[model samples]
Target: MRREDDHPKEHCAIFGIFGNRRAAWYTFLGLYAQQHRGEESAGIASSNGKEIRHHKSMGLVSEVFDESSLDALKGHLAIGHCRYSTTGSSLAKNAQPIIVDYSRGTVAIGHNGNITNAEILRAQLEAHGAIFQTTTDSEIVIHLMAKPTYNNRIEGLKGALKRLEGAYSLVLMWEDELVGVRDPYGFRPLSIGKIRNAYVLASETCAFDLIGAKFVREVAPGEIVIINKNGLKSIKPFPEPKRKAYCIFEHVYFARPDSLVFGENVHNVRKRLGKQLAIEHPVEADIVIPIPDSGNSAAIGYSSESGIPQERGMIRNHYVGRTFIQPHQFIRDLAVKIKLNSVGDALKGKRIVVVDDSIVRGTTSKMRMRSIRESGAKEIHLRVSGPPHKHPCFYGIDFPSKDELIASKRSVEEIRKFLGVDSIGYLSLEGLLGAVSFDKKNYCTACYSGDYPVRFDENVSKFATER
Candidate 1:
């Protein structure tokens, strides 16, 4: 199967609660906290010692669950997921917190990242009488755990996790306990948190704060933490190599600015990236304007460093979902305009520096620049808060195909000409890593350098090659 390289890896968010009778509510709140990580669909599964109950549907967390629905779910151990598809096509059947019933028992798994060997593993399982339930790699883990070789459940979990490759931070729920496992490379983010007498597992620390769960510590790279009535027990040294390379994009755009991952404060890291970008490619402009939401944080950083006043030059229509099948060119063109509009009054006759999170297809940026120009901005200087995406990401990001990526083929000057901007600059790779204060060996800059942390098969390798 060909990889969908153009599709942004909708790095999912996973949240789980152990020991709380109100597990569903806390799981719902935790998933809501991580909604920025993904928004295509949501699901929650709860287990009350005897059986597992779940409610899953396509849509945002708010749209999927309400007061009545949460009331019906009963359990002390639960897991919730906010997902964006990466491995397979977007379909209702692929929505997660995938529940499975097998010879061992019932289990529900909510996963936060992609698996490179998912197809191979799925094929093996299918040959051995494992009936596939969903298109996600997450279900593979459930099948693996159900294998009869291991002496105990924890050993089964470790054995299963060891078989997988690529990015993953998974939370699996059984009848009595919630288990959290991070991949050996720690390619994705997972942490442990606590509220009064309860333990939590989540993709980001921000999810902990949402439910007033105190940040205890991160679930170490290859560690498995089991949360049950007894307390938190970590199966240490579960099998890690040397350094940890959490996906750097978690800080760049996918995460909510308030969230913290890999010990880096996301908002501050973005601001630092913008400040450094200004230093690398300073532009003379009257006001600094952000591309809204994602760019706002970095724009402030740019304004602070460049001594430019930060202004609201563009406004986004949050009503638009991530994907739309307009079918016709005219409708697709109109969708872009409807998704975002420049504040004509604020932009008029100003020397503007437009700061944005990152430019992928460049079509969106091109349209935004044209809108700002139409709004009468005298001079538009473009600044990106992250390095130009020179290669595609296989871990879990929805970067465009190599040919569609502006940076993949065009130089800075050519990109400026194409975007109709006076000057264009992207945050340097060093500056981006520095902004996040990441150890060089522990951050994946694969999209910028084509140096993936994990090995891949021939087909998967094609997804990362520069066109």
Candidate 2:
């Protein structure tokens, strides 16, 4: 498991490919490209049109599957999942591409977001004598499918989907077809692509790029696409939501810079955010630097807008795995040290401005700033590319309780003092909304503004599955 990061933890990633003889291999490559979204576990399920096969394990994609494992999963249609347990324990059994043998042949689902009403639905099913195999919110869909009143399978799937309350970008596979669906509000991203004779579905366009797939388009909000030997068909099963709530964090932090999500390129949007941040809060400094990869694009925009030259002031150790064994407390203190190191030569006696994405709990930012100061920086100013995170996300992204978020309780000056930085500036809410290419009203600023489009029960934590 990863330590509490400086930003909210990514929800999950899902990918699927149809009509490929080497479906599992290609799905593996797609999941590898999306590993940054989730690293707790990886899984893939493939079908030969008669039956479905799957392999899942509790580790990174590379660690979970090898030559022998991938070779065993031969099929024409495949769906893969990489998970970060937002509501349940991080067990291998919970790893997805959740395959089940229902009455209408076998089906597997790779899900990318949380089902807010999982507990309520699970209870209702169990009262009807349902016995669940796993404690993930995603399993509720399979159970609902098994008990649907509709005779037609597509209608049944649609019925099951309509019952879901919150975020979901799903890729489902059965004997002869592949289906992809996004919730009505589009709380998570899902994309379509094509390669050779195959059709593809994934959490981001970056995955499609990895396997040489042509960019198609985003699976529409409240839309479902079904692919078979016949071709692809679209289904609009649910009523339109009151308004769209595309997770704005995807542009700020969650997505890979190379991906196109929610109608724009993530890198370009982030650069606009940086330039806007500089225009909103210009700081006079000797040099501008990014925390690392996530902050790189924004730093560039900041440099160009503020006339401050940007350089790599911090070096990242990419080899550091999510978990490591530390024999002593002294070694444990080096958690931040293991992942990041200050470029001392660049920082010595310089008035530095550190451009970072966001500050979640303030712990990581404090550690980073302390490290930068110790490297002989005379003045340090921190610039954030997004607004203060004041609420925990119930849609998909995993944030700690509201009290754990430093910005939730502290003012700007308080946070500056806590981090020991000379000054701090966060991008304004107006600046953030302006940076996105889509309609500002369509994006979710719930975490920043506490305007949740969908409300969850206060007792949400009781639902182990969330199922």
Candidate 3:
């Protein structure tokens, strides 16, 4: 409901529909389901073969669109995006389903991940007399595709995608066709699904379920799929990378528990992570409690494994909006306090094992623990399902840099003391790998292990673009 936890945030979610008469309407529903990915912006672009129309704004999906607005974006093909700004400012202009016009036709793109080479590419494109419309990395793809290097639009798109060097799962709408492409590394999630005869695509399978669409499969790494009146056609344009660096943090955090990602159910993997956490760090607490929503599944698993009773020690207010204007220093802390309230009945006089997914900055964990202790809790033992986020993520997840991470410089004991918890334990990198239903080598654990799968140029840093 809020950024109360220290978990990493996913960039955004993308959804596209082709050959569906209810494209715009279904797009709204899909974006609503994926509002968790991004609350700062919501947008949809639609095309009826000849004309393209779009509506986007800096707000949640429900706040941005109404029945009249959805009806106005009438088309058989549409692509929608709900964004959590990772690389750009949280402004309305940066809202996605970025629509552009070129010689080929109208093109709109909704991108789900960050582009690591965006700074270099943007500079190169500008040197070639390119005029940029927005400050988003997503615009790099549009400019690259708009160039006249290839004979056909499809060839141009393929070449443009080949030049991309970071996480991107895209939903692009061209005249008469809707296209979906996942980066060669598969750093983000995108799936192909169907609602009867109409083909659908989204950043997660959860979007399909909301609109009663049947999930088919994931868009292959380095592959592109085009859906038009002629039906779905596949194009493999790039060779697979040596290692597919799918973000494992999708299971630990960043993903909605109801969604399926990286070929595994997010909820199931999180529960398994909790079970593994208990095995790795056993404690004798009277009751197991989660921070709520983010920690709910893991706490349940911990209780199941340790034979400790599970209770809802905290209640989350689901209606908390993304932003609030605070006029005072004490009011600033309302960001976390407004969303969570310690249930005194379950927490009072109990030695509690408080389970959470991860701790990004120690401030949130520290403040949350203090609130629990003030609620008459006797002892608070903090257990995390994911390993310490010690390094920055270069993919879609917007994790803070090395200096911002509490675990980067401090020892575990130091972190426990800083957070003011009786004790603190985090899942090991090995244990986290064991919990996810995939081979360890395939998933990227750079944030936890400080081992980046994507190499960087000598001149480039994660902050190059921002700088």
Task: Please report, in order, the local distance difference test score of every candidate based on alpha carbons.
Answer: 0.82, 0.89, 0.87
Q: What is the lDDT of residue 359 in candidate 3?
A: 92
Tell me the lDDT of candidate 3.
Answer: 0.87
Model 2 lDDT per residue over 191-282, tens place: 99999999999999999888999989999999999999988899897888779999999999999999999989999999999999899989
Against the correct fold, how does model 3 do in TM-score? 0.97
lDDT of 1 by residue, 210-263 (tens): 889898888888888888888888886454577777788878877777777788
Q: How accurate is candidate 2 locally (lDDT)?
A: 0.89
Candidate 1 whole-model C-alpha lDDT, 0 to 1? 0.82
Off by over 4 Å in 3: 1-5, 86-88, 457-467
Q: How are the candidates ranked when ordered by TM-score, highest leading? A: 2, 3, 1
lDDT of 1 at 319: 70
Q: What is the lDDT, from 0 to 100, of the residue 463 in candidate 1?
A: 24
Residue-level lDDT for 191 in candidate 1: 87
Residue 214's C-alpha lDDT in candidate 3? 91
Q: Which of the two, 1 or 2, has more lDDT? A: 2
Q: Which 10 successive residues of model 1 have the least lDDT summed?
A: 458-467
